[model samples]
Target: MNFAVETPWVLAGLLFMLWPLFDDGVRHSPYPWLDILPSDAFSTGLTVLLRILGMATIAALVLGLAGLHRTEQSIEHIGHGANIVLLLDRSNSMDNTFAGKTPDSEEESKAAAARRLLTEFVAGRPHDMLGIAEYSTSPLFVLPLTENKEAIQAAINATVVPALAYTNISKGLAMAMSFFDDRELTGSRIVLLVSDGAAAIDPDSELQLRQWFKQQQIRLYWIFLRTANSPGIYELPTDSRNDNADAMPERYLHKFFTSLNIPYQAYEAESPDAMHKAIADIDRLEHLPRHYRERIPRQDLSALCYQWAVGLMLVLLALKLCEVRR
Candidate 1:
């Protein structure tokens, strides 16, 4: 808890507090035959207490004017969660429902469903450092990995816009992988891909992606949002001739991910409920104890200072009212 002041110049007013100590703020009167009167220790103690309260009130007012506050800080602790990056597909197909039609009043689009479920997933995992990236023709980096829940939720909610041209997942995966660059390896790293379709990656890009996954030890999870009559990640072609990358891109993509020799899982979701279940499974699987840093935002202390000043002023006012005059 680092304390700071926004307006240092206002602290100069603390010098006024010395006035109470020097004079005690009391009117002096002459009394004859002072030697005959015994000293009253109770009156002396009350006067001293009143002087201290006066100085405290002045100090509190000055501190309030100075805008005292605590600086933002980061704290590290052990937690049971992973550092996950969500790689969402923004291709045109995601704008349609699971039945391959524009969403109507009774149904929601795949993108909308992903956004809703992802938001809930983020809320549930309070300790995870989550990031978000979207891919269509190219990868769009929405946010970096951090424990800021509001920013993560906002990034996920922003993905419901109209779809882009195509899905270049290789580029998206690369972008997502780059998020862990220069980051502390304190826990499990995961790249979660949510898409309705897949695009074939070139031979050179596949080699680079494989090396990245191996070197970083990152886990990959794919949530394939299957539309009507669409091929699933495990579905094989009838003829061996159609078994190539171009024919069954989703299946081949899944195969490529598995070939990376890293932890990988794929889920085929035909409806919103299936997507929810997939997210739930992910939430359950990534619960490993690891160290993570959490940020605490800056806080203002001026209100507390003013409250102290007001309370002291009331006490002084009561003392003044109770005083008797000759």
Candidate 2:
């Protein structure tokens, strides 16, 4: 609730003003406001004053009102986000390189690229609440919605090589929704889906997911890594799945995004420069808005004038009854 107190105390001003006018003219002994009237009159005034003050107190509490003020838009508080969730894909395809990494050891999977991009996103948005999930044969909860970016990054790093064995897009969505249920969600809830698109989810399931996301008002983002044309596919690990060890699962993934109304883009290059561009693009989507957050502008409180109204009333009413107060 917005509030303001007048710079010059109204109570003090009212007391001084009433002093010369009423204090000198009145000298009807102690408890004189009551003395000026019959016993019944004093009782009625006291009762009326108490009743009015009681009503004011009740109004303030019920409305969360900072007294009453005319409606004015103040930009003091902007982009104070309520909540958001990052639904990242962690299937075996994530382990496949879109743009080739060092191409040695367990270091350069598509998942790694996505994580690096996520780090950039996290670095820029310190205020955003985020969570994570790794989906393949099924999606696994890596972290809950938290402000601890370091903890979220650590969990992402710990995810090891996964089999492009199976894809559970539905389960991942369900898990993400469950995270919101565990906490209180208020403003723009979002899900940034970073996928290599290997899973072949059913049409019905995909439509259901889309409807659910729309109803829940969760904004979906698609960062589809172009694995079909990348350099590292031949080197991809395939126990018996590929003759050439081509680990990229291209068809199902493309079909998944194209079917959804979600806006999507791809990282076409197979090098660091291309990967950086993809990261930059995503950063703009999430971070640019944050960067422009300052544009919301701040407001100098004007409602403070009304608070003085309350104080002034109290003071004048006091002076009018000062003799009786004693």
Candidate 3:
């Protein structure tokens, strides 16, 4: 534990401690009768002890005036949580209700529901390191992996419906994967993709996606916000009849993600309740024991020194009050 002071000159007051050695400060009384008592040595020792205490009291006061303090170093905090990257879709389609139309009732739009639920998710994971990225025509890394809950929620809330005419899921996933690069992170690594529409990726991007997930050992999840009358992941696209029709973009994308040799799950959310359940399931599955670091800043110690000085002075006062009348 290191100590520092605001005013070093105040320490000169400690020189008074040497005064006791020169004089001993014991007065000689002229009464010859009392001088013969064997109390001389005892009186000398008591005077020395009192002078030392007096110097200590003064030192404490001087240190308090000098503003003493100690610095706090960084510390490690352990917890059970994951490093989660929220891959959000900001395509214009998300601005509609699940019924596939602009929201007319008090019902929330798909984007609004996602933002609200994700805000709740971020708040609950205090120890987790989280990042967020949004995509429409391309990807935008909104916030880097961190434990700052406020910034994460603010990024989520700030997302506006994309003006682009496409959903670039490939670029979005690639950006999410980039968050884990060079990071010495442990615990469950995840990429939680939330989208209401789908678009196919190029063959090269798909190969890169597989390699990234496998190399980083990241789990993948897609929360498909299903609009009414749209083809679900398991169903044939509207344009085709056969099961092998890679016709529907979502179905093919789902197939591709599942084919990767890594933990993956896709949820089809047709309503707000289903959306909540999907997020809750992800929350339940991602927790695992891990260690994280926390930095605590330096704190002032002047008040503590003042407290000690007051306590010592109180002791001295009590001793003086009980002293003999002479």
Candidate 4:
């Protein structure tokens, strides 16, 4: 009582194997299986038509499946969610040394320390998506919004402290926005911007960036690594930015974030523990509070399947022509 349509190629292959031995062109003698076939004029014509139909079907099936795979890949990169783009400045100030947990040898600069912290940080952040944009003279996506924590962590840790690399905050922010624009997001978006300072940028660039941030409704937060003028931070055996300097670095950062309407915080690392804590603070701020929303409905694919079915029917016509002359 149960019946179902078979796959086009499979059905064609089954018919093809049987058709060659039973068709009218197959010279009906005591021809093995041909005796099982009917000689009724109506049935004989029907069988011949189906034999030709089956061959055309097999060809259509092969091409249709290939087309499906191509379309799937072409549309694969579309529709991602709102993401956290981590923007970091890779200028020389990033190279100042700091002490790690055990202070003996010289520690790494803020950039290196942050990278190290990111390895463990990514392990805990599996639900949220994140991207990274490194800035010096220009900005580039070292990693895009991805759930692959290991790859993201490795890329982050590999970052280098400046050895006065160019500092281009304006360029970095704009590039991050462009990357995020490609995704499909319903949740509130944010950008976690970690930088030493942007004392080198053109004045108009920051203003333009600030306007863009406000217009887009993206949250921006700061993590300032103190090398000089920052309190409780000293030039220990470890290297650091603004180490034992004055309050200028943190103060300037506060004003910058304030002007952009971004929530701001600072961390001073004369050593490693302090640097680790800074990264921890960033992980804390990443919790996005939002309203629960409905999911987008799955796209219907039956139309595509129907199109394949129609294309196959057309190919079946070709077989009728191939044998009609005979």
lDDT of each: 0.93, 0.56, 0.84, 0.58
TM-scores for candidates 1 onward, in order: 0.89, 0.50, 0.69, 0.56
Instruction: Write the residue-wise lDDT of candidate 3 on 1-326 in tens digits.
Output: 66888888987877866664665434545664865667787766777776776677777888888888877656677898999999989888898899988876688889889988998888888989899998888898799987777778888888754445678888999999999999886888999999998887788988898999999999999999999988898885444464442457888888898899899999999998899999999999888987777655577888888888898788777766756654
Off by over 4 Å in 2: 1-83, 99-102, 105-107, 161-164, 182-185, 228-269, 287-326
Candidate 4 vs. true structure, TM-score: 0.56
Evaluated at residue 212, the lDDT of candidate 4 is: 73
Residue pairs with colliding backbones in model 3 are none
The 10 consecutive residues of candidate 4 with the worst lDDT sum are 69-78
TM-score of 1: 0.89
Worst 10 residues of 2 by lDDT: 288-297
Q: Which portions of model 3 show Cα errors greater than 4 Å?
A: 1-73, 160-164, 238-246, 295-326
lDDT of model 4 at residue 236?
A: 44
Candidate 2, residues 96-130: lDDT per residue as tens digits? 66543334564577666666767776777666667
| lDDT of each residue in 1-326, candidate 4, tens digit only | 12223233444434444544455343233445666765789766866667666555544454344332211111122232335777877877676653213223455566666676666766776555677888878786788766566667777876753434766767988877665664665455667666666543456876777777776677676565655444331224244554422334345435566667655454544445766777777677665643222223244343464576576566555544655332
What residue pairs are clashing in model 1? 136-166
Please, what are the lDDT tens digits per residue for candidate 1 over residues 1-326?
79999999999999999989887766677787787889999989989999999999999999999999999998988888999999999999999999999999999999999999999999998889999989999999899998999999888878867889998989999999999998888889999999999989999999999989988889999999999899888998999999988999999999998888899999999999999999999999999888998889899999999999999999998998878766
RMSD of 3: 6.1
Candidate with the larger lDDT of 1 and 2: 1
